[model samples]
Target: MKFFKTSLLLFSTLLILFSCRTEEIQIIDPPIENELAANSTVAKLMKNTVAKDGSKDNIIDKASCLSVKLPVTVTVNSKEITVNDEDGYEEIEDIFDLFDNDVDAIVISYPIEVILSDYTVKTVNSDEELQRLAENCTGENEADDDIECLDFYYPLKASVFNANLELILTITIEDDEQMHKLIEDLEDYSAVTIEFPFKVILNGDTYVYINNMQELEEALEAAKNSCDEDDDNDYNDDDCDKCSTEGIKKIFANCNEWSVEKLYLNEEYLTEEFKMFTFSFRENGSIKIDNNGDISEGIWEITGEGNEMSFSINIPDYPAFNGTWYLHEVKEDSGEVSVHLLLEGNHLRFKSQCSTVKDGLNAILLAEGSIWAVESYKNTGEDETAVFADYQIYFYSENVVKAKKDGAVIEGVWESLNDGSMLALNFSDEPVNAFNKEWEVAVMSETEVVLEANDKRLVIKRIN
Candidate 1:
C-alpha cells in the first residue's frame, strides 16, 4: 500500500513539472526578399539616372562625357574672357560670330579642373591632358550610359534598416549628387525603403507621381532613350528643351500677328515673297494668312507634347506652306518673339512685333481730324514730290482713305498690316495708281510716316 502511494505522488509531481515547462518558440524572421536589395536592377537604374551629365558643358570641352569646371578663362578667337557659368558660353559664341571668315577656335586656360561622368574632378594642366580625357568620352551625339530622360524630384526621404528590420538611419537627399552617393553607398545586407509619393520628370517636362518601388522602376525603364539628350558640342541644340505644345499654342494665340522673317523650302530662299504675309492663329484651330488686304483661311494644329511637338498647317491654296513642321525653338529677345521651325532641309522663322508698338501705331493713324501732307516722294530714284504737292490725305477710322487736291478727290483703302511694320494702300484712281502697293513702314510717329517699296520712298507728315 505504501509503494502504491509513492507511485501516485511521483506521477503527480511529473505531471506538474511537465505542465510548468516553457514552450519551445521558433523565431521565424520576415523574408529578406521583401526588402530592396542594393544590387537590384531598380537600384542600378536609380544610380544611372542620377549620374552626372557632363554633356551640359560640351561647348567648352567638346567632350560629351565630361565638363570643365566653370569660372575658367578661355581665349576665343584671341579674345580672353572668363566663363563664370553656362551663360558665359554665349560670350564665346559671340566672339566666334564676330567674323564668319576667320578660323574660330577656343583655347582653355590650363590647370582648369574637369568633372568626369562619375562626378570625379580632375586637374587638366594642358591641352594634351584635356584631349586625353576627352578621347575617353563617347562621340558627339552618340549614346552614353547615363539616362538623361528621367530625373527625380529631390528632398527624397529614404529609410535604411538593419538585418533585424530595425531602422538604422533616415536620410534626406537634396540633389542629384546626394542621391547618387546614397545609391553608391548602399550595402547588399542592408535594406532601403524610399518614402512614397515623390515626383519624377520625364523628358524635362512630363511630371509623374511614383507611389512605390515597382512604379518607379517601370518609369525609369520606360524613359530610357526616350528622347534626344543633345549630347553634342553645339550649345544651341537643346534651346527648346523646355518647350511644350500648350506653351507654343499660347504664344501663337496671344500674338496679334506673325510675319515671315525667314523661309527656306528645299534649300530655296523664299523669304522676300512672304515678307508681306501675316499669320493669325485662333484658339479654334483656324489660321488666317493676311497678305496686305487679301486673306486666306487654313487649318492649324499642334500635336505631340514636350520637345517632340509638331506644328501642322493645311492651306489648300498655299501648298508650299503646308506641312507638318517640327517645332524647333521659341526665342524671345528684346521686344520681339521668334518661332523657328525645321523639316529636313527646309527652315521657317516667324517673328512678331511687340503688342505695345502695334497699339501705339494704330492709335496714331486713327487719331481724330488727322490730316497728313506729302513731305517727300521718290519713285524708282526719281523725285516725284510735285505729283501730290497740292494734295491733302485724310485717314478715317473705318479704313477709308481720300486724297483731295483742287476739286477732284481720289478714293483709296488703307490698312495697317504686319503688326504695324507695313501699310497697304489700294487705290483705283488713275492719277495715284503708283501708290497702290504694300509699303514697308521704315519709320512712323505722331508727326511723320516714312514708307518704302523697292526703290520707291514716300514721306507723309501730319499737318493737323
Candidate 2:
C-alpha cells in the first residue's frame, strides 16, 4: 500500500508541473501588425563546396560560392536554415584548409532573415512613453503563436555569429540613421537584442528586422518632442548628486568673487592691474583664476580646510619674498592680488597697476632694425647661476634678451635672440625698457609666463 501511494503521488506531481509549464505558454492567434521592409577581402581556392542538391554544404570549402536562392524552399540537415544577407555576397574570407591542403574561400550575400528571441532595452532619445513600454515588456515566448508588444526603450547590445558557431560580429547603435540601417539587413535565422537604442552595423550590411520597427518609431517621436528636458538640469540620477544645482551655484559665487579684467599697465599707470586680486572656492576644494592672452597666467591653489597657503617662487640670484596673501577680489574669470612682501632686510609694499588688456599678437612694438637693451650677466651674493643686466643691442624676431628693473613689464614681440627653443615675448607698446632690452621668454606653460632679462627673470603669477 505504501509503494502504491508513493507512485501515485509522483505521477500527480509530474502532471501538475507539465500543466503549469503549458499554461505559461498560451497560444494566442497571430496578429497581423508584425511586418517590416528590408534591405571585404582575402584569398584562396577550395573545391567540393556544394552538396548533391547544389546547396553550399560548407562555404569555406567552395572555390567560388555562387549566388544561389532557396530552390523549392528546401531545409538543410533537417534544420530550418536560410541564407543570410551574406549568402550572395562573395569573397568574404580566405582560409587555409590544412586537412584539404587548399586555401578555403569565403563568400558573402544579403537578405538575411533572423528569428530573434530576446527583448533588450534600447537607448534612444529620452522618451517617457517608450520608457514605459520597456518597463512593461513581457519577454519572448517560443511556444505561443501570438506575440505581445510594448512601447519601451533601453540600451541595446548585439552580436553576430558565423556558420562555425563563433561570434563573428558585434556592433553598437545610438543614432537613428545607423539603427534604421541595422534593422534592414539581418541574416536569416539570426537574433538581435535591443539593449540600448544606439546605432549598430553587422557584416558590412545594415539590418532591418520586424521586432525593432514599432518601438524605434515611437522612441524617435518621443525623442523629438522631449528636446527641452536636458540631462544636466535634471540632477536626480543616483550619480547626479555631484552635479547638483546648488553645487553649481556655489561654484559660480566663488567665480563671481574673484573676477578680474584684462588691462594694460606701464609708466602711464603707476598702479598695478586691478590693484587687488581675488579667488573663488569650489565645492570640490579646488580654486580657479583666469587670464587672457596678455596676462598668460592662470594661477590656482587647492588646500585642506581652514589652512593658509604659502606661494613659492625661485627668483634667480635674489632672495625670495615669502609672505601670506589674502583674497582681495573675485570675479567670474579673473581677480586682483594684495601680496605682503617679507624680505630679510626690508618690507616692500606694492600695489599692482590695472589696465585693459590688448591683443598679444597686436601688442607688438617691433624692433626689427632698432637698437634695444641686450641682457648682461650679474652675480648677486653667492648664487652660482649669475643674473644678467640690461645692455644696448639691436635685434630682429630671431634674438632674445633679459630685463633688470623690477618696475617694468616687457611689451614687444620677443624672440629667441640666439638659436634655441624658447618662448617669444611681445609687448603692448614701446616701453623704455623694451627699447633698452630684448626680453627672453623664460618660462612658458598654461598658467605661468616668465621672462628673464638683465639679472632678473620677472615672474607673472596668475592670481586671476
Candidate 3:
C-alpha cells in the first residue's frame, strides 16, 4: 500500500508540472518557425545552445535557464548610451553552461584611457577581425552547445599618440579592479566594471531565446500601447502628468559625479570648483561630499514637488550645508543637459554637472589622430582661411599642441575649458590666427569641430 501511494503522488506532481509549463511564458513571441532572424554568429550559437529539459523530459535539473527581453543601458563616462550596437562573439566557457542558452548579449562598462607607446595599435572594428580573435581563444574548453570560447573581444579601441603622432600601447591604466586583472598582462588602456547583471528565472517555463535590439524595442512599444486593451479601461492621471521638479533628485541619485559650475552668492561670484567640492549621489538616498582630501557620507532629500523644490543635505559635521536650495533652472541643449540650484537669502546660484568622462576622451581622441587644417576662419568679419589654411594643427600627449606652418612649428598647450564646452590653447608665443585663443565649441563631431569666439567662427577638418 505505501509503494502504490508514493507512485500515485509522483504521477500527480508530474502531470501538474506539465500542465503549468504548457502555458507560454512569453514576454515575446517570434514567428513559430525554425527560421531565426539572427546574425551568422548568433545563429550558430543558438543552433548549438540546447534548452534545459523540463518536467516532460524527466531529466529536470534544479536550475533555471531562461532568457527574457528588457532594455539594457550602458553608461560610459557619465553618458547613458543605449547599447544598440553588438560586437564579435565571446567564447563559451561555463563549466556546465549555467543556463542551456548562448549569450545573446553582454553589457560591459570599462574605464577608458589611452596608452601612449611607440608601436602602433591594431584595433578590431570589423567582422573579419572578430573571427580572427575567436580563432585565438586560449582555453579551448567545453562550452555550451558544443561551442567553446576562451575570451572576450571588446568593440571600441582607445589608443594614445605622442606629439609627433606616434602610436602608443593600445591599453593603459584601469580603475576597476576586475578589469585591471583582466588586462593587466595585456596591452592597452582599460575600462572598469564592478558587477555583471544578475537575474533569476521565475519558473521552469522560462527558456533562453534569440533576440536583438529591434525586437526588444518593439516589445517595449507593444507594452506601452497595449494594442489589445479594452475600451472600458481608464488611464491613470499620474501617468500622463508633466514631469515634476522632484525628478531632478532622481538624476542626481545616479552613480555619476556632479561638478559645481557657475557659482554665485549675494551678487558675488566664486570659483566654480570653490572649496574643491565634488558631489556623488547614490541610488540608495545616500550622498557623498568630497573636498580636497576630506570625504563624508550622508543622506539627502528633496521636499517640494512640481516646479518648486528644495534640496536638503543631512550631514552632522557640515553645518554650512544646512540651507534651503531652490530649483533655479533645468537646461538641455546641443546634446548637453544640467540642473541649477538657488539659495534665496544666500548669494548662491550653483550649476550642476554637464561634462562626462566620455566627453573628455572624445575631445582627446579627435584632437589627436588628425592633422587639422583651417577650412574656414571668420575673425573681424573676414574670411581668413586663405591665410591660415596652410597651418596644420596636431594634438599630442600631455596636452601638447603643435601648429606647423611655413616651415615653422610653434608648440602650445591645449586644454578643455568651461565645462568642456570650450577648447582653450595657451601657446609659448601666441599665433596671429583666430584659433589661437579660447574658442566656444559650437560643433564637435567625428569629422570636424567648430569653434566660435568674439562673433568669429573657425572650422577645422580632417580631410584624409
- Score every model by TM-score: 0.49, 0.17, 0.30
Q: Sort the candidates on lDDT, descending order.
A: 1, 3, 2
Q: Candidate 3, after superposition: displacement of residue 61 in Å?
A: 51
Candidate 1's C-alpha runs over 4 A off are 1-35, 236-464
Candidate 2, run of 10 with poorest lDDT: 40-49
Worst 10 residues of 1 by lDDT: 17-26
Tens-place lDDT per residue, model 2, 12-42, is 5434422221223222322223222222000
Off by over 4 Å in 2: 1-155, 159-180, 183-217, 228-464
The model with the greatest TM-score is 1
Candidate 3 per-residue lDDT over residues 32-61, each given as its tens digit:
232222233323332222222111110111
Deviation from native of the Cα of residue 346 in model 1, angstroms:
24
Clashing pairs in 1: none
lDDT computed for candidate 2 = 0.29
By TM-score, the better pick of 1 and 2 is 1
Give the alpha-carbon lDDT of every model: 0.75, 0.29, 0.42
